[model samples]
Target: MNPQFEELQKRMNHIGNLNNYLEDLLAKIPGNLLSGKQQAKLMDVLLDDSDLTSLLEGLKDPRPPRFVLVGRTGVGKSSLINAMSGRYLAEVSDVEIGTEEARRFTYESDGQVYFEVIDTRDIGESEAFTKDADAEAELAAVVKAFRPDAILFLQKATERAHSDIDVESAKKMMLSAGYGLPMVGIITHVDELNPSRIKDPADYPPGKLALMEDKKGQLRRIFKEQKVPVDAIIPVSSYIEWSQDPDDLSEVERGELTIGFDGRYGIEELLDFLEQSIDIRAAIHLGMTIRIHKISERIALRFIKVFSTLAATVALSPIIATDIAVLLSLQTVLLMIIAYLSGRDLAFKTARELLVSLGGIGATGFTLRMIAQQGSKFANLILPGAGSAISASIASGGTYAIGKAAVAYYLKGVPEEELNKVVKNARDEFDRGLE
Candidate 1:
């Protein structure tokens, strides 16, 4: 691995550790005091009705501002956060989905104005059996903890504007989480078009322009249909302008800030709206929530794996001796079934398959080897003799491999499309260099 990447990984680990400690401490805090009939009793003991009302209102006051970054898996949510904060607090990569949980990254400026960026995973892509429930629960949690002033629904402009599965999923999720909440649409990757042919929307060929308008219209209608009040639609491209150097500007000193991919034109407009519409305090609060959520989700996911492994080990121990074959077979079958069901979640699915394959081969070999050890009877049964234990051990190693991969996947927020693209690009680059 690159040294910089390795350093980043280490830092992320440290941050996660700190967040876990905080969560543990917070969990210990007591619940609210107002309960059932006690509410009336407390009110009676208050100095006066006005004073009691003020106290209750103060206690029930809403938390800080949190901006939820909702969109498809590989959209530039993390990149945008990094750019806005002017730092590398959130991890960024072409191959990874960095925000696995609802994390907060806060931006505090001067007095009371604050912005908190909240990052959440692609809840829409959750398992079919759990997607609705999971999404609903996730929405409820977000709404309850921090009543976000606005949600930034993101999508790739290069990708279809309408009929995009992620866009649809996002609209549904937002409504479920915060009914009638104000929202803004952000289209990413607009800088990807060929600049020489057509630099702006006006310059595009009539046919393509028409198509673009239709898409925008469709998207607008969808949101309107869903009753999600749209504030402003901003198209942005962050990394497309990475290749440019601002120091070499001409005498004209362009009005636009080019980030690459011709995104400066569109994103500048969006930034203007963000500055004007979103309260700075709310943005900072959302950013903090995003940072916190990232830390908690990562720690919680790791804990889940550790707990599950320990439970599986203990649960399987007693049955292994008496019914190793049956138990092993069942475990393998369950994993395979789960792997098949997890269509888009490649990391999880792959891990499940690895476990299934390992258990299957291990148990088969162990049984055969044991039977082989029985001399004539084993030979008659056609077993691998002393190789049974070795095979079983090797097979069990699959569990470890998958577990490690899953942990890394969640920690890094790597996505399937980005992984494939990187691999493909590397292959093409290698071929070119060889030539």
Candidate 2:
């Protein structure tokens, strides 16, 4: 055989080995923990043979994910946007009527547009508006142009009295525009329902929680009664508490005015539901456009746990060559998933480059020393004559470090130089068992 052909065959074997290892690792994880369907999807994404650049380009397509906000006036549509985006993108007003013309709000981060929010005004507030053919026609025109991927129907939670105007308006919008998009019912002003006005949403009394559930049920029932299909009805308090700027106050009294400001609650749940309801492409677009660190952190942590378990399983037997290979593969796949969750476009080549920079899978002297040191540290933890438990500890610690580093790199946009430092710090922490 030609030398070049032999080398090519060797590389193919290596690739095949890695792919099989990853599949086995994924299978070891419980299906309930990571559903088989989700596992399969992740495998497909990680092992795809498609052009990496083309895949990334498609992920980063300029077309923003669009959402249409449909609600009556004074329902806190603007506030909802502000809470979800963590920016005052929409104008909150005390006036009963919102902007007359349909307005588009684009959310951009680091010069890249992520989402387009369309606020449809003058709908569902009055019976006359719903009855007016002209108003209906105008709404149809707006919906046609916006081409929204989802519909968010906002309703004030405190309002006990119900009306058919909202239902009628939704029917008209869905019918005239022929939008088959998923509809989500958002019950805003949930905090207002509590007479005592609790600042912490999680601290709500059992009765309060029950009331919230009941309200959500009511909203769902109303939509069902109107024959309008809704994906979910989430209750959220856009702004339960606010604090004054510390800088604006005197130095001595700076913290006085802002003593107990608990941020918005239920927003994360709403965002999660929205992300899951849409396809992966739209979810990625939304995540990139919206700066929701909490949601991203939650997802990244979950992936870290999943991958860490897989890594530990591979390390249990402690074959230097196989252990390092499996660990590296797990970490590489982990970083890729973290990047995706963070709404960052990471090509396969970039992931491979990162792995090489950290430490290539082919065992070098440096890599061997590091693995031995990690294994030695936890060797005592295993029972007498048992295989080294050091692998398990190192696996968990390294995975935790990788997760933190990935979060900083992809979500926080840390520079490459600084990101390396972050990775180093994480590794040190893991070695010390502090992670």
Query: Top TM-score: which candidate number?
Result: 2
lDDT per residue for candidate 2 within 269-364, as digits (tens), equals 887887766644566445545633354554466556656656666556544444554456567777876675555545555775765555424553
Work out candidate 2's RMSD over C-alphas: 14.5
Regions of candidate 1 where Cα sits further than 4 Å from its true position: 1-65, 82-115, 127-135, 161-168, 176-180, 194-212, 243-263, 283-435
Error of 2 at 75 (Å): 1.2
Candidate 1: worst-modelled 10 consecutive residues by lDDT: 336-345
What is residue 418's positional error in candidate 1, in angstroms? Answer: 56
List TM-score per model, in order.
0.38, 0.53
Off by over 4 Å in 2: 1-58, 62-64, 90-101, 107-115, 160-162, 240-260, 279-281, 289-435
RMSD (Å) per prediction = 25.2, 14.5
> What are the lDDT scores of the predictions, listed in order?
0.43, 0.61
